[model samples]
Target: MKSREWTDVGTKLFLATLDGLADAELDAPSLLPGWSRRHVVAHVHHNAEALRRLVSWAETGVENRMYANPEQRAAEIEASAVLPAATLRALVTHSADRLAADFDALPAEVWSHKVITAQGRTVLAVEIPWMRAREVAVHAVDLDAGAGFADLPNDLTAALVADAVAKQNTHGNLPGLAAWLTGRTAEAPSLGRWL
Candidate 1:
């Protein structure tokens, strides 16, 4: 999808996901082990902001950490998780708006420019938005938020499935990411049995 399209869809998906949750629901654990719904929401919000900052920094011919480190990022999310429910929702709303505006203002030329990664890699600026979309799209389901992978446009889901398939990692888990991503199963199987 185009950058503009991705930004619009991301806004919709994230908001819909947030809207489905009750104040206490945000603390519920998700499909991703050890991550609560709030953690996932904060991760999505932080990632969108981080990616926007990366693109902006690239435009300025400078580089910075996309996140201070995984530990720091986790800390930020955990801290945010304790805010009054309204405050947390407001944070998400504000961050999403900022991300959309930042992306919408980016020039066409910058879309193709390289964004240096915090880990010493680079990806095109346009790719960053796509990554943001993927996070919102997939984790929406991971959190059991109202909108899910099935709610997303088929083209987008298909693309995400393809990406997941290409980057499949077993981690010694049953059924595995490959099977789940390829429509082989809706959820992972019990780890007691592995083929």
Candidate 2:
């Protein structure tokens, strides 16, 4: 529950993911339709940068979008995909570090600030690290690194399972919490199915 602890999970997960992948493997498509491993990594990198911006804006008493906008954020991940594998890896590495630094620099109380994301959802600043951690951990599997919800520690996997369940109603036919976390489902449940 500590802010640093959450960030540490993200940092460690990302690093472990990096170790598991090869340059060519990063661009390979996984189970997510039309998305390569690169896409997943880009999403995580951009997400970190976006969180840094969000936290900074919150600290300054300025209400900025958690992401510039949905389209804009998507464009960022696509842009990162243009880089060669090595360059993309470097970008992700640095972005992760910067994100952790940003989180570490926040005043202890600032983690409690509420911010509205581009998705039109409001979440506390302290929750950002958990958000990023899930991204890295789940997508690490998308890259076919042999990591999965089952690979995560029990506590983290339990939390992710809960989140996957809570998101099921709004997001549509997604791999239910148990399916995804337990590897019973191969593809993510279709968001449109529930919608």
Candidate 3:
């Protein structure tokens, strides 16, 4: 599969979900606690921008971190979350387009260049698209616009499930997860919020 195919399918799904929301519905709370649909939309746009910066770092041979810091990311989302629905939609769509174009223009040799994610993991530049795929696919559901994980492409869904589970393991409380997966516990493990 092309590195960005996951991104392509994810973006298509996310845009469709966002399209189903009405202007007034943007103010409604999303499946994500405390975030309205507008906040989800805004975060989607900023995520694209952040990933694009990584692509730029790869393309230009300059170091560009995804965000200055965690607070900058949170601040950007909170500020953009209050914009008019139409404006937020247009901005997100444009950002996605811009990120795709940037990805297409990245040099083949640069695909192997290292970049740091907002999460602070050093990954190959090629992983940038998958990073975006994760955001859009999950946030589409968080929008609470009648979309769900089952609506995503099967392969993407599998990849997301694996990624999310691996993340939980990395966070270092695995006994609960192991017990639940093995059916030794009736209750599923409690996890921190999804990114």
Q: Give the lowest summed-lDDT range of ten residues in model 1.
A: 165-174
Error of 1 at 60 (Å): 0.9
Error of 2 at 94 (Å): 0.8
Task: Indicate the TM-score of model 3.
Answer: 0.96
Instruction: Write the residue-wise lDDT of candidate 2 on 1-195 in tens digits.
Output: 643564576567766876788787877886577878888878777877887778787688787776656789878888897788887888788988898778778898988888876667788877777777777767766666666667667777777767766777555544464476578878654444210
- The number of clashing residue pairs in each candidate reads 0, 5, 0
Best by lDDT: 3
Q: Residue 142: error of model 1 in Å? A: 1.9
Error of 1 at 153 (Å): 0.5
Task: Report, for every candidate in turn, its global Cα lDDT versus the true structure.
Answer: 0.73, 0.73, 0.89
> Judged by lDDT relative to the true structure, which candidate is superior, 1 or 3?
3
| Model 3, span 1-195: residue lDDT tens | 354998887898899999987899999999888888898999999999999899989888799999999999999999999888889999999999999999888778999999998888999998999999999989988988888999888888888878877888888758888899899999988788865
- Residues 1-195, candidate 1: write the lDDT tens digits: 464575567568778878878988888887777788887777777877788778787577577658877887778878887778788788878887888788778787877878766556678777877777777777777777666666777778777866664444434543565576578989864443211
TM-score of structure candidate 2: 0.82
| Residue 99 in model 1: lDDT | 82
Candidate 3: regions farther than 4 A off: none
